[model samples]
Target chain A: MSTAYGVAAVVLVVLASALIGGFGIRLSRTTSDFYVASRTVSPLWNASAIGGEYLSAASFLGVAGLILVHGADMLWLPVGWTGGYLVLLVLVSAPLRRSGAYTLPDFAEARLESMLVRRTAGVLVVLIGWLYLMPQFQSAGLVLRAITGAPEGVGGLLVAAVVAVNVLSGGMRSITFVQAFQYWLKLTALAVPLVFLLLAWRADGTPGPGAGAATWALPLAGGREYGLYSTYSLILATFLGTMGLPHVLVRFYTNPDGRAARRTTLAVLALLGAFYLMPAVYGTLGRIYLPGLRGGDMVVLTLPARLVGGVAGDLLTALVTAGAFAAFLSTSSGLTVSVAGVIGQDILRGGVRSFQAAAVVAVVVPLGLASLTRPLPVADVVGLAFAVAASSFCPLLVLGIWWRRLTSAGATAGLLTGGGLACGAVLLTLVGGPHTGLAGALLAQPAAWSVPVAFVVMIVVSLLTPGRIPPGVARIMVRLHTPETLDLDRGDWRPRSS
Target chain B: MATRHDDASVYERIEADDRFRELRRRFRSWVFPMTAAFLAWYLLYVALSGWARDLMAVKVLGNVNVALVLGLLQFVSTFLIAWAYSRYAARRLDPLAGEIRAEAEHEAERERA
Candidate 1:
């Protein structure tokens, strides 16, 4: 009986996404429309799409489950995740949009004025996309195993198929509307039960923070030394890393102006903040309810069932399942769009034919990797992606925009230094058992080290190769400075001919 | 961020525009050192946690190990750097951008002849 509901929920979510994509296909006309919705998406719609993709299975389920297991320390994951956007808003959103790059590679090329730098940036974007997508695929399999008692491979395969179809058919244009709608759908499906659960918890004698919950009350273990270090590292990575993310950075270009870019980021922050709070609540409650379960990690799926077992339990589980499916699909589609864009532009011609083929290559490679291997904890896997991003593209984006002295040689050096180190750490993680705290965290979460390494490498290399800095830097700056109405490529990007 | 000068010139147009020179002077004022200091704080955490594992004892809170303090600091530092970067950008970088923008506009108007 529960299996039937789970099956029904999955079908509904897939149908919903397809329905949205089908409608989007009718509206998709130009390549710009396909890639960035002609840079005219409203903030509200864009906000919804951002929320949809941002609230991955990790956000919807893993963070909460982690909180249930680890206490307040885990809270930092959601806090840092949401705060990453706030950083994006304050530092990058508008200027990046003004830069007129579709992918991170575009930003790197224009910023550093070198194809080598652009290619380096392009490769790193794929690595980050692939690293990030692996977890989504893993979780999809995990969720399937939990719901249908099916093998782990089934859900990952199913999701890849669904995500590939949607992305290939509609591109970014259709994916935008579909993801926007999924964000709300996921929120409502999760939120409604949460209110009921809070009431139910209150009625069930309103238990205290639970038995082992006392340890969570202590903020830092000792003085603020460790706290200071960890927080700063995470901050540096998230704040710097946002502009380099092909998926997130691509969104900024959709806005029409700097002001619109700023406003869209603000809306995203609010939407993300609201959604983030819900997961922590689920995590906190999971502790009180499902403490004895194996893999305290899967508690998000277990909570609704434990709280309202029987028909209601089945229904709530189905709703959560559907939301989880939405998370996987939305994020995967966004990643596919970004990765395919990079593959098409850098490696292939980005023709319609190439775009379609690139989409398949982009999705297939990661799905194979995910099927062959089990990833680390969801948070850890995601953090590694951030670390690689920090090392490679983060330096390029930050220095490219702000520092005038940066050369393409510098960018290439930084990308290799940061991305190479990060990839090495990821390999260590795959091969080795857990290291110590900072080492484990660094290995597990290498962003803090990789970002600085990248930055330092860029600065050092640029100093040595000062002569290679591009001659057109001034003119490019003028173009970047020009307002959208005066943009030379406004009509060009929106070319009517295929 | 440089101009295109003729080939006979020995140097590229690395001239620091008035605002930029000022911006550079001001950037080194507090921020460069400050970011370096914060960067140090982060590295210390990694060093202490990984290499100096014996430097501190492990305590338990709920199920979170004591090392979480270091982990959480990573998040806190992210906010601090973000705030710091934004503050620096608004104070130093924006003025330079505005001045350059105004100068560009003025130059364009003069060129209408």
Candidate 2:
């Protein structure tokens, strides 16, 4: 009965997200509307949509598990993830809004004055999108395995189909609404049980951290030097990584102006920070209450039942199951939008057909990967995604925005140098064979070194060859700087060569 | 020196619809340097953590650990930087951009004429 209820709840959220998107298809008429929602999303709506997608499988399932295993130190995952946006808001949000870019590749090519840079960026965007999406797909399998005891493939297929249905039917216009709705659904689902559990705790005189929980909290991992290295590297990846995330950066483009973009980012910080806090509470609670339980990732799902213990426990569990599924559906849909967009533009011949085809690839490729690889712990998989973002796109965005001297050769050099190695390390980490201390460190925490090498390669290469800067630099600058409501509000997405 | 005529010509060009022109110029000033600033900030972060070993230990919130605090500040700094960009653009750069945009449009129209 519990499994059936959970599966049913999962189906409901997926259908709902898809249905919302399908409805948007009705309003989506123009190509622009299809791609950028006609640039009409309100700040609140856009923020919620961003949040819906941002709180991926990691936020829903993994944070608590990480806390269950690692203690307060794991709080960094949610904190860093939420905090990354603050970095994005400051570094790239407003200027990015000014840049009038349809995508990350557009920003890079125009900024660096090189088509090569754009292509490299295009490739990185797809890679980062895939790396990030893999976890969401894996989480789906994990969720189904927990609930239905079904083969992993069944859940991955189910989520992929649901995502494809929503994305192809509406493009971004529809997906935006679906994501916004899912954000609230995820929050409510997580929040309700938290309230009940807290009440239960109060009635039981507020329990203290247990032995297993206390150990998880203490940062005691034998070797101090290596532990320090691990801590710092993880920080580097998550902190700098947010600026380059395609979905997050894409939201700034929807805002009316640079100021509005910043405001939207602020809204997201508060929203995400609030949502993140609840998971820590679950994790802290899990440490005391559910010690020695395997599959810590299930901590979020298992908490209510462990605390309350009865018919009410079953009810709360069902609610959390629904929310976890919402997290999977919401994030998968968000990733689908970016992956589908890239494929449509770069690979497909006709735009709309390409979009539909791309949507299928977006879901299918990751689903296949999820089936083959036993998913890593949710937060850990998300961490790998961050390392890639930090090494590849972060350098590109930072340099592209402010460095007039950023040449295509430099970008290509850095991207290949930094991105190639990081890609190898990530694959090694995901492969799950021969995990040694140093190998584990390199595979798990490559960003600290990788990000710099990427940046240096771009700069040095650009300097070695003094070449023509893009003629469009000045004109593009004007578009990016001008506020939409200002007298220069051309609102045109075209890049002009001056 | 043909000062009067040169000054008059310059004044005439300025008086024409080039209000947004300044926006791009101001943007160029900020955008170029800001990129450098981020690179510096990123390097500063890596260097402080990797090479300057003892620095992050200069602590803040108890068990909140200074290293972790500084690391978290990196994220905070990103938000502040983005916010600063918006304010600078909205107040100074955007206006200049509008002037340039108008000048471009007007010039394009004149060429057609």
Candidate 3:
């Protein structure tokens, strides 16, 4: 638990990130490279980068912490998160890549032929980006506070500053390399410590995580009221939400083609499945070892030192600390790039300079929000962001890709209705103070009700306003559904130079 | 050469083509059923975890219960589905889509030339 190892780990990760980012900038010379790496990334590298960016603090630290506290029920969080990519792969991956859109708003405009829907989607992208980014910042602070006992704000600021610098320097291309490297680093950090911890437990005669506590080991039996409803809502939010995340969806744009996109997603599913297997191990081990540990988030960091007290334990702790920091940096960098891309394309004049400026805005606003608000448990807050996304963009993407009858008016109404309801529910839960019973559970987990309502509203509205279907719907559908191997005038939806 | 006006009509013609319809149908038929099946499987797992606590808690191994087994199975099923879909896409969806795309592009090129 020495401060020196933790500080060194933080410094090392930052230096490595900066170095990789610098390498990316040198490779990137054109505007396309700045946005989507000129769509040349191979599936393995793209999948690693996606895995790196996708496994945020929620996966690294929060999953273990929640599992440690909530028992088997919390396993759903990681399962739902990984299964989300299955849904993404089966439904959205190829067609979305084939859509030739740089951002979600571009997809909207291309599909609906309406700037209004595009602008609305642009706004939702920024909002969701902020919602997702706030937790990374907050958890960065929490993890730093646990490691070096630094002020909470300092860690968030350090992460924000580093992410902003990385994004502004290399954009997506550099961030890709940085994230891919971080994925391996994170896996080593957790997996290595785990081997030693398990050995130590075996040496100590292999005690279980309090086998006598019946409810603790049982799924949904921990006296959690409305457990059924909450679990279903969590499933809906995560399963459908992966396609809607601004950061996650934007990574697909880096694939060389629709086939590569699908291949990359398949790789992501495998990579993520492998990584997720370790966190639950840490959590279950924590139950027996760190019984008195109150701050559940600190379980991963504290376990190595508690179980193996020596220089080696200190080194292991430092390694996990480095991984935690990597989680914050890689996820924040991805979110910043996606958010800045939207802002640069929509709000500011289109150029790399605007993207740089937008990156600064993207990081600063979330840092400010993290400072102003009370930090919720990292995974819970992230779940709210997923709920909002599942309700909004999931519907839009699914309908936009498959259904030719989808009208602009339908999209706009659905985006507003679904995004608004989910966002309103999230805001109420965050700000309106805790209310127990049905209302609280419903507000806390809005995806079950919100997602279905969003889909129905979209379908009904599109049917009612049949005449509002864009005249170019057929052409757009052809562009989207067709493989990129086809030589057709898929209308250019690239970021326009302003 | 096909004019800009003709390009729109060409896309519409391609959209209405039997090959295009087959390509779309192939993708939808495979993906829709798979999506529904996996989603239903996942939800059933979630529902079982939520409502059937005693069932999930029944120990199948040393300190490993049905809940843990089912949870791990979700991971297995996800990987399985991903693998299956990629194979299906490569064999069934991608090849037919490629053929249709090639034909459409060839038709468009003949009109242009």
Candidate 4:
């Protein structure tokens, strides 16, 4: 691809993001606006924003890359990513919105009424957010270097600066608009070139995936060790992980009520279902057209030029580059806001200034880590984050909402056992080098063990610590499960008509 | 009915209310079954791909196989579950929850008076 086109595309995306971000704040006011956009976003807009933020570089680049390398088995990555929202829709969405909490820690405090539980949750939220953000920053470098041939660090630095600026200036209110727009932009950017790419394929009588050794089409093919267990672990993490992401949960808080949250999630299911379909196309086509590519991440970037070949091809590649950057920017901004929100609430005094300071800290810490860490496959790193979230927050959200017997001690114990173990596994996987046997698989994908352990520990501790149940459990349960139309003085209420 | 500031009693009243019970029952009726079924479906897909590669690899159409169709069905099931859940909530759950809310509000107002 031409350097000029690539650079131009990156510049335009950044400028557009900045413009929307800078102006988005003028339309925002009040603490509610900063936190949850005053809980006034409609289902369509909220859904779009969710789709925008949720579909990170993993969805944009990593899925195709994985599919190119591993073939059919990797399809589950996108399946789980989108289906994770379905889990969110049915289980967590409405009640979480009804809780009227600004962040995950607030929800914990509101539900458990224990400062210890709340503080524990606050820590996990920051850890998960930072873990998730590191990959986005690293992938931005990959995209930038792939396109413009710039130094790898340039992309991460550029994204960190842009995201910090966006969050510090306007927080969630500014981001909602920017993310919603980026969703459509990303869809068009990937989808438009796709039509041409398909046309090119058809014109050339599109070959099959390189006369595949039949196993390529098989789901758990290529003699993957512990393939069955690994698949189950991946399923466990992603299926349960969606509800636990700090950024995803905060979006539900932007809905006016539980009903709207349900609606927004439904819309998200549709939008994401559509958006996810396009990547498999790129992945499959890359296999057929650009076989034996060195880096699967670059498959999406290079496929268009390889298949189409001309100024037109260069333009399409540039479009995909722009889309990839949007993926990084929108996802990084959302994570930064959620992480910064937690930091601002727990670490610093609450307010816009604290949030601004936290935003810098949020992005910069991850940016520094991205620089220091050896680059893992972007999708693998993201999966590790999901595993940690599933083992930790999934248990918390599920048990917290439904079970009144849950005590603060139980919740804290569960988070530590679940989240702590998952994080330990992630660290081992990152630093210990790849292992070759059962030990390797367990460490590589810990959700299968860790999530169950968390749940069991929580239940057992809650049973033993029965006396420690928060006295406010009934009222909190009523508030969370009850319809908002109820007129009871749900104490500490805020007017929603802002 | 309970005093305005007595949140525990108010919650107790709401908890005891027939409509609130009905709301909880109806919401749980769908959500629990739907969640269980989706998880079952997803796990089955994972299990099949994990343990039964031949079945997954069996060709159904030209260049398309069972795995591909099942993969697509994952998305289909997600959309279906989401759409079905939304409709169910709108039709059955919301109205019941609303009724309970209205009663709670009425009780609060009477207590205030």
The clash count for each model shown is 15, 22, 0, 1
* Candidate order by decreasing lDDT: 3, 4, 2, 1
Residue lDDT tens for model 3, A364-431: 99999999888767888899999999999999999999888899999999999999999999888877
- Tell me which residue pairs clash in candidate 3: none
Local accuracy of candidate 4 as per-residue lDDT tens digits, A1-498: 798999999999999998988877787666566777877889899999999999999999898888887788888888898889888887877777677676778888888888898899989999999899998999999889888788999999999999888887787888998999899989998999999999999999867776763677777776356777888898889989988899998898788777788888888888988988888889889888777887688888898899888999999999999999999999999999889888887888877777778889999888988998887778888999999999989999999999999999999999999999999999888776456688888988899999999999999999999999999787888888877556555544332222
Give candidate 4's root-mean-square deviation (CA, Å).
2.2
Write model 3 residue lDDT over B26-64, tens digit each, in one string. 888999998989889988887787678789889898789
lDDT of 2 by residue, A320-410 (tens): 8888878888888777787777777766753677778888888888877877876778778878878888898888787777676766777
DockQ of each: 0.08, 0.14, 0.64, 0.65
Quote the lDDT for A242 in model 1: 60
Judge candidate 2 against the unseen true structure and give its global Cα lDDT, from 0 to 1.
0.73
Better of 1 and 2 by lDDT: 2
Rank list by TM-score:
3, 4, 2, 1
lDDT of 3 at B46: 70
Fnat values, one per model, are 0.01, 0.13, 0.71, 0.83
Q: Model 4 off-target regions past 4 Å?
A: A489-498, B1-4
Q: What range of 10 consecutive residues in model 1 chain A has the weakest lDDT sum? A: A487-496
Q: Could you tell me the C-alpha RMSD of candidate 1 in Å?
A: 6.0
lDDT of each: 0.72, 0.73, 0.88, 0.86
Error of 3 at A266 (Å): 1.7
lDDT of 1 at A279: 78
